[model samples]
Target: MSIKIENLTHIYMPGSPFEKRALDEVSIDIQDGEFVALIGHTGSGKSTLIQHINGLLKPSSGKIIIDNVDITGDKVKLSDIRKKVGLVFQYPEYQLFEETIEKDIAFGPKNLGLDEAEISKRVIKAMNMVGLDYESYKDKSPFDLSGGQKRRVAIAGVVAMEPKVLILDEPTAGLDPKGRDEILDKIKDLRKEYNMTIILVSHSMEDVAKVATRILVMHQGKCILDGTPKEVFKEVEVLEKVGLAVPQVTYLAKKLKQKGFNISEDIFTIEEAKYEILKLLKGANNND
Candidate 1:
């Protein structure tokens, strides 16, 4: 479902000595079924904004309209709102406390008061989506799983909820290179299979460049940039100024252009760069 935020401003501890404005007149329209990446430095209000999307934090003064209804209005239940938007926080593994992986993954569905048969079915589906074996690992203690497995288990908990929109905050934090790849691929597959809208909060431009169709950049409580990944990354200096680096492939393409090679500047993936370079060499040889 599409989300519309207008004149959003969030104030913490209003009329107090420690008053802080987390979001300063921030507004954006998130289209449905789009893979969106939210980027910002440490305290740029990225976390605060996402919280408002799911009604975890109420905006002091603004409107959050989802699917054409202003749910930010009174008389709307937060539980009902969350039923449509699933949120996976940073280091979600810490929240998995059930005795066994099966129970933990089933926690969300069970909370909805589903029957045992349906809950069991959802648990199995979620586990398999994350590449976890249900037969071998379902009965095992979640605490016994490795870090990567634990992360997957945590994600399965959210998947079990079957929300229309999935919001993930730093989903690959603290993972090794291989773990990061596996998790990203699994998430991509889940989005494709379920046709769920995804809002990914992250710091890695490379990850977003590879997946997100649109990127939003925040700086010090305000959204400074918003566009397609290629459009946003075109301003590499601005991205770097905001404490985010451009994708390595974009950098390499820029360097090649400066070295008198006729290469496309919109390169974000390594494979795209390799293909363009090969074509450029062929054209140069024909000229010779």
Candidate 2:
């Protein structure tokens, strides 16, 4: 599903001494099936903006339209909106409490009032979607599983709900390299299999470079940049001013270019750097 935000503004404790404006006239359009990466330093309103998308927080003054429905309307029900927009918060595994993995995965579908048979089917499907073997993990305790496994089960619970839009906030937070890669790969698989719109809020420029089709940069409660990864990463100076950094490889590429090497400063991934280096070497050999 596509999301449209127009003139969106949000405030905390409005009219109070500690009042803070979290979002300021923020507006953007997220097209269907787009993997959008939201990046910002702390207190830049990234979290607050996403909460408005899923109806977890109301806009102080603006409109949040999902699939052409004005979700901010009084007539709209938040619960109904939530069913279509599933948010997997940071460290989602901390929310798991069911006795077994099967029950945890079944939680959301069951709440949707699906029949027992249908719920069972969804649980199995969700497990498979997350690459967890149903037979092997179904009866196991979620707490007994490894950290990454627990996270997968948590994601499965949300997947069971069959949301059209999936929003993940720091999904790979606190994970080791292997665990982090596993989560990212699973997210990619989920997007391919389900064709859902994904909004990933992350700090890792490397991870975003690898997965995001588009990037949004927020600073001081305003969206300062919005474009494809290549377009956004090109503004390294602006990003750095906001306390954000591009992928390390992008920096390396920039330095190489400064040193009089013919390389594109837009290289954002290690693989891209390797390819460019090889091509440069080949070109030099031909010249020699």
Candidate 3:
């Protein structure tokens, strides 16, 4: 589903001495099936913004339109809005309390009041999407599985709900390299198979560069940059001032350009860098 936010502003403790403005007239449009990475420093309103999208937190002022429905309307039910926007928070594995993986994944579908047959189908489908073998892991205790496996099960619960938009907040927060890769791969797979709009709130520029088709940079309660990965990363100076950085490979590419090598500074991924390097080598060989 597509999302439109217009003049969105949010505040905390409105009448108190500790009142703070968490978001300020932040507006963004996210088209269907777009993987958008929301990046910002800690307390830069990243978390507050995602909460508003899912209707978990109400905006102090502004409109959040999902698929043309104004969720901010007083007449609109938050529960109905949530059905179309599923949020998977960081360390989702800690939320798992079911006796088995199957039950844990089935929880959301069951709450939707789906019948047994349909619920079972969705549970199995969700497991497969996250790369968990239904036959092998279905009956196992979620807590007994490895950290990555437990995290997948937790994510499957949200996937089974089959929301039109999936919002993941720091999905790879504390995983090791292998576990992190597993989660990221599942995210890619989910987008491909489900065609859901995914908003990923992350701190790792490398992870976003690898998967995000678009990036949104937030700072001091305002959205300062919104563009494709290359366009956003090109503002390295601005991002640095906001306490953010582009992918490490993008820095390397910039250094190569400075050293008089013919390389694109926009190259942010290892694969892109390797291809550019190979092309340069091929050109030198032809001259030789």
Number of the top TM-score candidate: 3
Candidate 3 local Cα displacement, residue 2, angstroms: 1.4
Model 2 is weakest, by summed lDDT over 10 consecutive residues, at: 264-273
TM-score of each: 0.95, 0.96, 0.97
Candidate 3 overall Cα lDDT vs. reference?
0.93
Error of 2 at 77 (Å): 1.5
User: lDDT of each model, Cα atoms only?
Assistant: 0.91, 0.93, 0.93
Q: Candidate 3: misplaced stretches above 4 Å? A: 285-288
Tell me the tens digit of each residue's lDDT in model 1 across 130-213: 999999999999999888899999999998999988999999999997998899889998899788999999998878887898
1 or 2, greater by lDDT: 2
**Residue 99 lDDT (model 1):** 98
Give candidate 1's TM-score.
Answer: 0.95
Cα RMSD to the true fold for all candidates: 1.6, 1.4, 1.2
Pull out the clashing pairs in model 2.
none
Output the better candidate (1/3) by lDDT.
3
TM-score of 3: 0.97
